[model samples]
Target: DQQVKQNSPSLSVQEGRISILNCDYTNSMFDYFLWYKKYPAEGPTFLISISSIKDKNEDGRFTVFLNKSAKHLSLHIVPSQPGDSAVYFCAASDWGYQKVTFGTGTKLQVIP
Candidate 1:
Protein backbone atom coordinates (compact mmCIF):
# COMPACT_ATOMS: atom_id res chain seq x y z
CA ASP A 1 0.00 0.00 0.00
CA GLN A 2 1.19 3.46 -0.88
CA GLN A 3 1.32 5.52 2.27
CA VAL A 4 1.89 8.81 0.48
CA LYS A 5 -0.11 9.93 -2.53
CA GLN A 6 -0.26 12.89 -4.88
CA ASN A 7 -3.59 12.50 -6.67
CA SER A 8 -2.80 15.04 -9.32
CA PRO A 9 -0.19 13.72 -11.69
CA SER A 10 0.34 17.09 -13.29
CA LEU A 11 -0.42 20.76 -12.80
CA SER A 12 -0.10 23.84 -14.96
CA VAL A 13 -0.04 27.49 -14.01
CA GLN A 14 0.82 30.80 -15.61
CA GLU A 15 3.93 32.63 -14.67
CA GLY A 16 3.56 35.06 -11.78
CA ARG A 17 0.59 33.11 -10.39
CA ILE A 18 0.40 31.03 -7.29
CA SER A 19 0.76 27.26 -7.61
CA ILE A 20 -0.49 24.81 -5.05
CA LEU A 21 0.51 21.18 -4.82
CA ASN A 22 -1.31 18.69 -2.62
CA CYS A 23 -0.33 15.48 -0.93
CA ASP A 24 -2.01 12.93 1.33
CA TYR A 25 -0.63 10.28 3.59
CA THR A 26 -2.17 7.35 5.44
CA ASN A 27 0.53 7.11 8.08
CA SER A 28 0.02 9.12 11.20
CA MET A 29 3.47 8.37 12.54
CA PHE A 30 5.07 10.78 10.13
CA ASP A 31 6.59 13.68 11.99
CA TYR A 32 8.49 15.42 9.22
CA PHE A 33 7.36 16.56 5.80
CA LEU A 34 9.65 17.47 2.91
CA TRP A 35 9.20 18.70 -0.62
CA TYR A 36 11.67 18.06 -3.42
CA LYS A 37 11.97 19.40 -6.93
CA LYS A 38 13.44 17.36 -9.77
CA TYR A 39 14.43 18.46 -13.20
CA PRO A 40 14.99 16.33 -16.29
CA ALA A 41 17.88 13.87 -15.94
CA GLU A 42 18.81 15.28 -12.55
CA GLY A 43 18.36 14.25 -8.95
CA PRO A 44 15.62 15.71 -6.85
CA THR A 45 16.71 18.61 -4.68
CA PHE A 46 15.27 19.45 -1.31
CA LEU A 47 13.03 22.45 -1.53
CA ILE A 48 11.14 23.14 1.67
CA SER A 49 10.15 21.27 4.78
CA ILE A 50 7.88 21.43 7.82
CA SER A 51 7.88 19.65 11.10
CA SER A 52 4.85 18.25 12.89
CA ILE A 53 5.29 20.73 15.70
CA LYS A 54 4.59 23.58 13.29
CA ASP A 55 1.78 23.92 10.80
CA LYS A 56 3.76 25.94 8.32
CA ASN A 57 7.26 26.67 7.12
CA GLU A 58 8.35 29.12 4.49
CA ASP A 59 11.52 29.70 2.52
CA GLY A 60 11.65 32.43 -0.04
CA ARG A 61 8.80 31.86 -2.49
CA PHE A 62 8.10 28.32 -1.28
CA THR A 63 5.95 27.35 1.66
CA VAL A 64 5.03 24.01 3.14
CA PHE A 65 2.11 23.26 5.39
CA LEU A 66 1.34 20.17 7.41
CA ASN A 67 -2.08 19.18 8.75
CA LYS A 68 -1.52 16.36 11.19
CA SER A 69 -5.19 15.76 11.87
CA ALA A 70 -5.91 15.21 8.20
CA LYS A 71 -2.61 13.52 7.33
CA HIS A 72 -2.30 16.03 4.53
CA LEU A 73 0.32 18.52 3.41
CA SER A 74 0.71 21.06 0.66
CA LEU A 75 3.39 23.19 -0.96
CA HIS A 76 2.66 26.66 -2.17
CA ILE A 77 4.74 28.67 -4.60
CA VAL A 78 3.92 32.31 -5.04
CA PRO A 79 4.56 34.13 -8.30
CA SER A 80 5.49 30.90 -9.92
CA GLN A 81 8.15 31.10 -12.60
CA PRO A 82 9.22 28.92 -15.46
CA GLY A 83 12.41 28.01 -13.69
CA ASP A 84 10.27 26.68 -10.85
CA SER A 85 8.75 24.10 -13.16
CA ALA A 86 9.66 20.60 -12.14
CA VAL A 87 8.38 17.34 -10.75
CA TYR A 88 7.58 17.93 -7.11
CA PHE A 89 7.73 15.06 -4.69
CA CYS A 90 6.11 15.08 -1.30
CA ALA A 91 7.92 12.98 1.27
CA ALA A 92 7.21 12.07 4.87
CA SER A 93 9.16 10.40 7.61
CA ASP A 94 9.38 9.85 11.31
CA TRP A 95 12.55 11.50 12.51
CA GLY A 96 13.50 8.59 14.72
CA TYR A 97 12.65 5.92 12.18
CA GLN A 98 14.73 7.63 9.49
CA LYS A 99 12.75 5.97 6.75
CA VAL A 100 11.02 8.24 4.29
CA THR A 101 7.97 7.61 2.15
CA PHE A 102 7.61 9.51 -1.09
CA GLY A 103 4.58 10.31 -3.16
CA THR A 104 4.53 9.87 -6.89
CA GLY A 105 5.63 13.30 -8.02
CA THR A 106 3.35 15.89 -9.56
CA LYS A 107 4.76 17.54 -12.65
CA LEU A 108 4.32 21.29 -12.55
CA GLN A 109 4.56 23.32 -15.71
CA VAL A 110 4.65 27.10 -15.64
CA ILE A 111 3.74 28.96 -18.78
CA PRO A 112 5.58 32.20 -19.33
Candidate 2:
Protein backbone atom coordinates (compact mmCIF):
# COMPACT_ATOMS: atom_id res chain seq x y z
CA ASP A 1 0.00 0.00 0.00
CA GLN A 2 1.13 3.54 -0.71
CA GLN A 3 2.10 5.52 2.33
CA VAL A 4 1.32 8.90 0.85
CA LYS A 5 -1.50 9.87 -1.50
CA GLN A 6 -2.71 12.97 -3.33
CA ASN A 7 -6.36 12.72 -4.18
CA SER A 8 -6.40 15.68 -6.56
CA PRO A 9 -4.76 14.94 -9.87
CA SER A 10 -4.66 18.55 -10.99
CA LEU A 11 -5.56 22.09 -10.08
CA SER A 12 -6.16 25.33 -11.94
CA VAL A 13 -5.91 28.80 -10.52
CA GLN A 14 -5.91 32.33 -11.83
CA GLU A 15 -2.73 34.24 -11.68
CA GLY A 16 -2.42 36.29 -8.50
CA ARG A 17 -4.76 33.93 -6.71
CA ILE A 18 -4.23 31.23 -4.16
CA SER A 19 -3.55 27.60 -5.03
CA ILE A 20 -4.09 24.83 -2.54
CA LEU A 21 -2.85 21.26 -2.74
CA ASN A 22 -3.59 18.47 -0.32
CA CYS A 23 -1.95 15.20 0.66
CA ASP A 24 -2.68 12.39 3.07
CA TYR A 25 -0.55 9.71 4.66
CA THR A 26 -1.30 6.61 6.64
CA ASN A 27 1.96 6.33 8.54
CA SER A 28 2.18 7.89 11.95
CA MET A 29 5.89 7.24 12.00
CA PHE A 30 6.41 10.03 9.52
CA ASP A 31 7.92 12.96 11.39
CA TYR A 32 8.95 15.13 8.47
CA PHE A 33 6.93 16.27 5.46
CA LEU A 34 8.10 18.03 2.33
CA TRP A 35 6.57 19.50 -0.81
CA TYR A 36 8.40 19.30 -4.11
CA LYS A 37 7.67 21.06 -7.38
CA LYS A 38 8.58 19.38 -10.66
CA TYR A 39 8.84 20.85 -14.11
CA PRO A 40 8.92 18.87 -17.32
CA ALA A 41 12.23 17.23 -18.22
CA GLU A 42 13.48 17.98 -14.72
CA GLY A 43 13.53 16.37 -11.33
CA PRO A 44 11.46 17.55 -8.41
CA THR A 45 12.70 20.67 -6.65
CA PHE A 46 12.26 20.91 -2.92
CA LEU A 47 9.92 23.71 -1.99
CA ILE A 48 9.08 23.74 1.72
CA SER A 49 8.77 21.34 4.62
CA ILE A 50 7.23 20.95 8.04
CA SER A 51 8.16 18.91 11.06
CA SER A 52 5.69 16.91 13.07
CA ILE A 53 6.25 19.25 15.96
CA LYS A 54 5.16 22.18 13.84
CA ASP A 55 1.66 22.68 12.52
CA LYS A 56 2.73 25.20 9.94
CA ASN A 57 5.84 26.41 8.16
CA GLU A 58 6.04 29.29 5.72
CA ASP A 59 8.58 30.50 3.24
CA GLY A 60 7.81 33.56 1.22
CA ARG A 61 4.80 32.75 -0.95
CA PHE A 62 4.82 29.08 -0.05
CA THR A 63 3.43 27.54 3.12
CA VAL A 64 3.00 24.00 4.30
CA PHE A 65 0.70 22.86 7.07
CA LEU A 66 0.71 19.52 8.81
CA ASN A 67 -2.02 17.87 10.83
CA LYS A 68 -0.52 14.93 12.66
CA SER A 69 -3.69 13.54 14.16
CA ALA A 70 -5.46 13.74 10.81
CA LYS A 71 -2.49 12.32 8.95
CA HIS A 72 -2.84 15.11 6.44
CA LEU A 73 -0.80 17.95 5.01
CA SER A 74 -1.45 20.85 2.65
CA LEU A 75 0.50 23.38 0.62
CA HIS A 76 -0.61 26.90 -0.09
CA ILE A 77 0.72 29.16 -2.78
CA VAL A 78 -0.28 32.77 -2.73
CA PRO A 79 -0.44 35.04 -5.77
CA SER A 80 0.00 32.11 -8.08
CA GLN A 81 2.04 32.79 -11.12
CA PRO A 82 2.16 31.21 -14.55
CA GLY A 83 5.74 30.19 -13.87
CA ASP A 84 4.51 28.21 -10.90
CA SER A 85 2.67 25.75 -13.11
CA ALA A 86 4.10 22.31 -12.49
CA VAL A 87 3.56 18.93 -10.92
CA TYR A 88 3.70 19.11 -7.14
CA PHE A 89 4.63 16.15 -4.99
CA CYS A 90 4.26 15.58 -1.30
CA ALA A 91 6.88 13.54 0.55
CA ALA A 92 7.13 12.14 4.02
CA SER A 93 9.90 10.51 6.00
CA ASP A 94 10.11 9.01 9.45
CA TRP A 95 12.59 10.26 12.00
CA GLY A 96 14.46 6.95 12.15
CA TYR A 97 13.58 5.71 8.68
CA GLN A 98 15.79 6.29 5.68
CA LYS A 99 13.18 5.93 3.00
CA VAL A 100 11.05 8.90 1.94
CA THR A 101 7.65 8.16 0.48
CA PHE A 102 6.19 10.50 -2.12
CA GLY A 103 2.67 11.06 -3.23
CA THR A 104 1.42 10.55 -6.78
CA GLY A 105 1.62 14.26 -7.46
CA THR A 106 -0.80 17.02 -8.43
CA LYS A 107 -0.40 19.02 -11.58
CA LEU A 108 -1.05 22.72 -11.05
CA GLN A 109 -1.73 25.29 -13.74
CA VAL A 110 -1.82 29.00 -13.15
CA ILE A 111 -3.92 30.55 -15.87
CA PRO A 112 -3.00 33.96 -17.09
Candidate RMSDs in Å, in order, are 0.5, 0.7
> What lDDT does model 2 reach?
0.96
Backbone steric clashes in candidate 2, count = 0
- Per-candidate local distance difference test: 0.95, 0.96
Among the numbered candidates, top TM-score falls to 1
> What tens digits encode model 2's per-residue C-alpha lDDT throughout 1-99?
989999999999999999999999998889999999999999999999998999999999999999888999999999899999999999999867757
Candidate 2: stretches off by over 4 Å? none
State candidate 1's TM-score. 0.98
Predicted candidate 2: what Cα RMSD to the true structure?
0.7
Candidate 1: tens digits of C-alpha lDDT, residues 1-112: 9999999999999999999999999988899989999999999999998889999999999999888999999999998999999999999999999898999999999999
Candidate 2 weakest ten by summed lDDT: 93-102
